[model samples]
Target: MTTPQALVLGIVQALTEFLPVSSSAHLVIMQDYLGFKNPLLLFDVILHAATLGALLVYFRKDIGKIILSLVRLKEKSDEEMLNRKIFYFILVGTIPTLALGLVLNQWIKAMFTSVTFTSLMLLVTGALLWISKRRADSERGIEEMKTTDAFLIGIMQGVAIIPGISRSGATMSTGLLRGIKKELAFRYSFLLSIPAIIGALGLQLREALLEQTLPSHPFPWIGGVLAAAIIGYISLVLFRKIILRKKLHIFAYYCWTIGTISLIIRLAT
Candidate 1:
């Protein structure tokens, strides 16, 4: 890919990755229409790694607390116990996500190539976001979260494996529908993505190694990675603010608008 194309792709990935929008949908649309190509999966892996790094840096403090709590799991304090439970909740959430992803792996991969189908899925995502706005006020915290809630949210995350289905949006909407407080739901959704993103990166890395596809020019790829990481961090911060302000449904209108336009284009072509 050219430097400008790489940079644009990187920005799209970072901006949509953590937002209530599907990064995969945006990437696929760009590739299909703009004819940008990155062989051997190098560009994809780099971008994913960058976003993963962003997540790690943003949640470093929470990760440290979770690790410390695990090390001293025998403690009797309420705070310590709550931390331990949060750690386990993440694990529990990953179980269903991994299971569903594995079973639907090929099916999900197929969806990535179809802009028309992805556009339809984007409509589904928009509907979910709109519905989330109607949920009653919730004040429950991590202390009151149950394994079932995590599992259900995980199922939503798993379903988001399909192209155009926003992973963050689905999981957060499920959490809110389950009556989870907005802040906690927002925090947990991103936290839950850590394992999912890592697993995806590992798989992509293995594919790249097997294909042995190396880029002749590495500078643009490096630039892409930096752009993705920096933009991803900013997107995360902005998403948190939007969720806290109870205005997440604002994204619903964007999704619906894009989905309709995409559908019309697909039909015309």
Candidate 2:
């Protein structure tokens, strides 16, 4: 891929990585429709690592507080409970995706080659979003959730390992339906993202090394990584605001419309 192409894909990866939309779907669609060659899995690693860094940098203060609070001699009941539960929830959410990514990585890639599957998965993603939008208490905060709710949301995060499944949409919807507030749901979804994203990328990176699929004209990753991280950070903030304003149903409509169109295009092609 060209430098310009790499930059554009980096932006897309950053944005879709956080948004309710499916990043894998958009990447596949762009690669197919635009004739963009694969930039190798290494480039993908750089992009995700950059965004991971972005999340770390942007949330550094909150992350520090959370970490410190965990080790402190004394903490409030509610704060302590929420922190402990979220720590476990992150662990639980990472387990299935990491295991599945390692074991089923090839099978998942084969599915990616099938445009029909991508489109179908997008359709499934949209359906999920719409279902939650209709039934979920769009007003609940994550702080209001129970331990079971976190685990249940964790399961949905596991399912998002498939290309078309929307990780944020799935977890947030699960949280919402469980009566967690929108901002709280979004935070959990994104926070859960930290572990899941890193684990999946690491697995994929390992597979790429074994397969020796590294591209020759590798993008240095500095620019693409920075772009993704910067954009990802901004996206995280914007998405939180959007959720707080109770505008996620707009994303519900977006997922449905785009997924439907993509499916139709696949069937027609």
Candidate 3:
């Protein structure tokens, strides 16, 4: 990809990744519109790595606490105990997500090829988000979260592997329906994504290496990564504010509008 194309893809990936919109769907749509025959696997991996870095940087304090709590196992403080439990909760959540991803990997890849299917899924995502908006506000925080809640949320995350099904939307909606506070739902949804993204990055890297699809000059793509990281951090911050403000339902309309238009265009063409 040229520098301009890389930058465009980077911006799309960054914004959609955290905006309760499907990044994979947007990338597929962008590539189709740009007439790219195949995705640049190496470039895609790099973009994801950049967003993963952004997640780490944004949640560094929480991650640090988790790490410290694990290392100093003897600490019986409530905060340490909470951090340690959260670490276990993440692991539990990852289980169903990884399993579903593995089982549906091939099917999900096929889904990426059909814009009609993706557009339809976008409608589904919108409905899910709208449902989340109707849920009465609850005060359940991470300290009150249970393993069942994590597992259920993870199942939704796994299902969101399909194009147009937003992972953040699915997981966060699940958290909300389970009565988790909006802030914790938002925070936990992204936190759970850490393992999912890492697993995906690992698989994509292996595929890129085996296919020898690495760009002849990767330096140009570095700009894409930087753009993604910067925009991704900002997106995360903005999304947090939106969710907290109970305006997440607004995206439902955006998704529905886009989905309807895209579906019509795909059908007409």
Candidate 4:
């Protein structure tokens, strides 16, 4: 890949990864059009790592509290207990997600090659976002969340593994449907993504190691990672504000527009 191509891919990954738009769909389309023959697996692993770093940095305080609570698990202050509970909620949410992802891995991979299918999934994502806009306002926080809520949201996350189904969009929509406050829903969605992204990277890392493939353009890969991390952090901050303002549904229009265009292209071709 060329430097410009790498930078463009990095920007797309960062912008769409946290947005209601699907990053995987954009990457697949871009890769196909650009005719990139490099080891995309390694490149994608690095790009995801960069976004993972952004997530950690953005949620450092929450993560720190979770870690501290775990470290002092037996001390049991009221606040520490609350933190522990929240941590467990995250763990509970990840269970169904991991299970469903493993089961659907091959199906998801196959869908990546079908732009028409991905385009249709984007329409589904847009519909979910639009539906979320009609949900009544909520004030529930992480402490108020139930196990069933977590599991259901996890299932949404798992389903988002399909190309063009935004992970952040699906989880946030599910959270809203479950009566989570908008800001809290957004926060938890990204927080939940930490484990999901890590697990994905771990699996990809193992695959890359086994394949013994490396990027042909190492400098471009490094540039892509840096670009992704920087842009991802900015996007995360902006998304928080958008969610707080209850403007998340605005992204639905974009998804619908893109999906329509993609469908047209597929039909014409």
Candidate 5:
């Protein structure tokens, strides 16, 4: 991709990745408009790694607390215990996500190149966000989370493997619908994605290595990664504040509008 295109794609990825909108869908659309005949899978991996870095930086305090709690296994303070429970819940949530990702691997790859499929899935994401808004206020926190809740959220994350199904949207919406507290649900959704993104990056790297298709000139993509990582941190902070206000459903309108326009344009052409 050209430098300009790379920068634009990075910006789009950063914005959409945090919003309830689907980052994959926006990437596919941007790639198509930028005249990429094939999916930039390797470039995508690099960009994802950048966003993952943003997540790590943004949530470092929470993550550190969890790790510290786990290490001092002797500590029985309520806060430390809650953090430990959250750590286990994240592991439980990753299981179904891994299973679904493996099962849908091929289909997921194909969907990346299909604007029609992505557009349709975007509408589904809209529905999920809208429905989540209707759920009554909940006060449950990490201590109240059950294995079943984690499993169900994992299933939602797995389904989000489809292009245009926002991972954050699906997982967060699932948590909200399950009556989890808003802040906990938001934190858990992104924390759970830590494992999922790592697994995806690893798999993609292995595929590139085995196929001997690694990009020889990766410097062009580095600009994109930097853009994604910087803007992604800002997006994460903005999204968290929005989530706290219980305004996530507002994104559903944007998703619906974009999805419909994409379908109409693609069909007419």
Candidate 6:
């Protein structure tokens, strides 16, 4: 690939990594557009690691507080108690997704081969967000939540592994449907992305190392990782504000518009 092609791929990965759109789905579409095959999966791992670093850096202070409180849960200290509860909620919320992912990771990738499937799944995401926004109360906070609620949200995350199903979008929709306020729901969604991405990248990284056949130049790889990290951080903060104040119903509109147009273009061409 030309340096220009590599640069474009980097930009696409950066932009879609945090947007409600599925990054891998867009990457696959764009790769098909360019007629590129045998993509260096190492690059995929690098981009993912960069985005994970961005999240950890962005949430550093909150992560620290959560960690300390979780450690002090043995005392059952009153103030520490709430934070510990949230900590447990996160763990419980991650389990279903992780377990399901382990069971079906290979099969799920096969189902993603059809562009139409991806395009249709994008519509599903839009519909889900639309229904969730309208149906949700948007007033409840974390304290009101139960363990069963968190586990149910985890199942929602598991279903989001389909191509074009936005991981953050699905988790947030689950939280909203469970009566959590938009901002806190968005916060938990972002928090959950950390663990999901880490597990995925680790698995992919191992595969890439063992199976990589082509070697990529160091400079483009470095450039892509750096740009993805900065862009991912900006996307998180910007979209987060949008999620909190505005109705996410509009994002559904965008997704449907884009997905429908893409499907039409593909059929026509």
What is the C-alpha lDDT profile of model 6 across 38-137, one tens digit per residue?
5557777777788889889988977888899867767677657767777788899889989988887997767555567777788888888787867455
Q: TM-score, each model?
A: 0.96, 0.87, 0.96, 0.95, 0.96, 0.91
TM-score of candidate 2 to 2 decimals: 0.87
Poorly placed runs, candidate 2 (over 4 Å):
36-39, 73-78, 95-104, 135-144, 212-221
Over the stretch 65-182, how does candidate 5's per-residue lDDT look in tens digits?
9999999999999999999998999999999999999999998888899999899999999999999987738778877889999999999999999999999999999999999999
> Which lDDT value does model 2 have at 232?
89
Model 6 CA lDDT for position 70:
69
lDDT score of model 6?
0.77
Candidate 5 vs. true structure, TM-score: 0.96
lDDT, residue 104, candidate 1: 88
Question: What C-alpha lDDT do the candidate models reach, one value each?
Answer: 0.87, 0.74, 0.89, 0.87, 0.90, 0.77
Candidate 1 Cα errors over 4 Å, as ranges:
37-40
Name model 5 segments beyond 4 Å from true: 209-219
When summed lDDT is taken over every stretch of 10 residues in candidate 2, the lowest stretch is 135-144
- Give candidate 4 regions above 4 Å deviation: 37-39, 209-212
Global Cα RMSD, each model: 1.5, 2.6, 1.2, 1.6, 1.4, 2.0
What local lDDT does model 1 show for residue 5? Answer: 82
lDDT computed for candidate 3: 0.89
- Clashing pairs counted in every model: 0, 5, 0, 0, 0, 0
